[model samples]
Target: MAETIQLVFYIILFNFLLLVVTDVSAGGKMTQPKCHRNSDCPRNLCWPPLVAICDLHKCFCRPQHVNLVVRD
Candidate 1:
């Protein structure tokens, strides 16, 4: 009886830990939106806004200096 209770407690603890790990990993990874051109993304007017340009059919952003480039 005590052994059964301990087993159930361990199972619950394992599930809770798995849930927390899954949530944490998911929060760290983000999926970028698909795009055909740079115009598909929103323009950032604020200086040094962290993010984003449409490249290779996807919107990609990395930590770096982002300069707004306008082509006629």
Candidate 2:
């Protein structure tokens, strides 16, 4: 009975560690906001290297590259 309990505990721990590793490996992307317009997203909220863009009703920050590909 004690061995069975220990095995269950180890399984649970392994699952938890697996989830953490997956999250870390995925780079833990930042959460974006749902928006209908560009005005809904504010520039101040975006980080320095990233700019807020509203595309397909989602507002998220993307890397700034001379504003060539996408405009604000």
Candidate 3:
């Protein structure tokens, strides 16, 4: 039926929109460390809305601003 087809189409569209939003937000990697509290980040580091994993040892403010130094 036309209604069934329309519903399926809307579902597909919604899924596609979700995928796009996720991709734009996360760029596909999910292992990145997100700050849950102030202790998660060092004093000198500026906490952005989101953080990404730089390597096995550290999570950075972004993919580009790696090797950040934290002041005591």
Candidate 4:
């Protein structure tokens, strides 16, 4: 019975998180402070391990700077 309750809780939590993620990325409202060039960013702010990168006419952290989550 406890396992069943746990599973139900997980499912509800998953659905809530899903809605949040969807809403954030839904209507182009997820413009979390993007950049276009190095000069556009603060000096030495995103240096070293997190080099600023320009892509699609925007600047951001290097892909390697972020951790990727993959599931089976």
Candidate 5:
């Protein structure tokens, strides 16, 4: 019974670690708002590297790291 409980605990721990690894590995993807101001963002502010941008219609984070370029 003790062995079974230990195995179950390890399994749960491994799953949690795997989830954290997967989340950390997936970078450069952020959720932004479709508006112009910091109030539009979920955190009530936009991150420094990503600011608000509105193209007269929809708004999203303006990339601050790289230049405005469209990729294939």
Candidate 6:
């Protein structure tokens, strides 16, 4: 009974480690965006003025900017 418990614990630990390593590897390959301002964004990707976050040489508008809307 004790051996069975030990085996189960090791299996869980191994799976947890595997998941962590996979996540880290995948994150290294993700692509982000780049823009100094809304105007710098191309027509197809332009939204509006907002803070930007840089990741993996890409820039994306901050989450708070999602709530903003342009009125013309």
Backbone clash total, candidate 2: 0
Q: What tens digits encode model 4's per-residue C-alpha lDDT throughout 24-44?
A: 433333222456654564444
Would you estimate the TM-scores of all the predictions? 0.39, 0.41, 0.40, 0.37, 0.38, 0.38
Best lDDT among the predictions, by candidate number: 2
Q: Output the worst ten-in-a-row residue range by lDDT, candidate 2.
A: 22-31
Candidate 6 residues 1-72, lDDT tens each?
A: 999999999999997875554334334322234645444433433223333344334544433345343221
Residues 25-67, candidate 5: write the lDDT tens digits. Answer: 3232333346554344444234554544444333345544533
Q: What's the distance in Å from true for residue 44, model 4? A: 30
Whole-model Cα lDDT per candidate? 0.52, 0.60, 0.49, 0.48, 0.48, 0.46
TM-score of candidate 3 against the unseen true structure: 0.40
| Candidate 2 Cα errors over 4 Å, as ranges | 1-29, 66-72
Candidate 1 has an lDDT of 0.52
Winning model by TM-score? 2
Question: Which stretches in model 5 have alpha-carbon errors above 4 Å?
Answer: 28-72
- lDDT per residue for candidate 2 within 1-72, as digits (tens), equals 999999999999997875554344324444356776656766664655656666777665555563333424
Q: Alpha carbon lDDT of residue 34, candidate 1?
A: 72
Q: Give candidate 6's error at residue 46 in angstroms.
A: 30
Q: lDDT (0-100) at residue 52 of candidate 2? A: 61
Per-residue lDDT of model 3, residues 1-72, tens digit only: 999999999999997875555345554533345554424644434234444434444444443344354321
Candidate 6 overall Cα lDDT vs. reference?
Answer: 0.46
Deviation from truth (RMSD, Å), model 6: 11.1
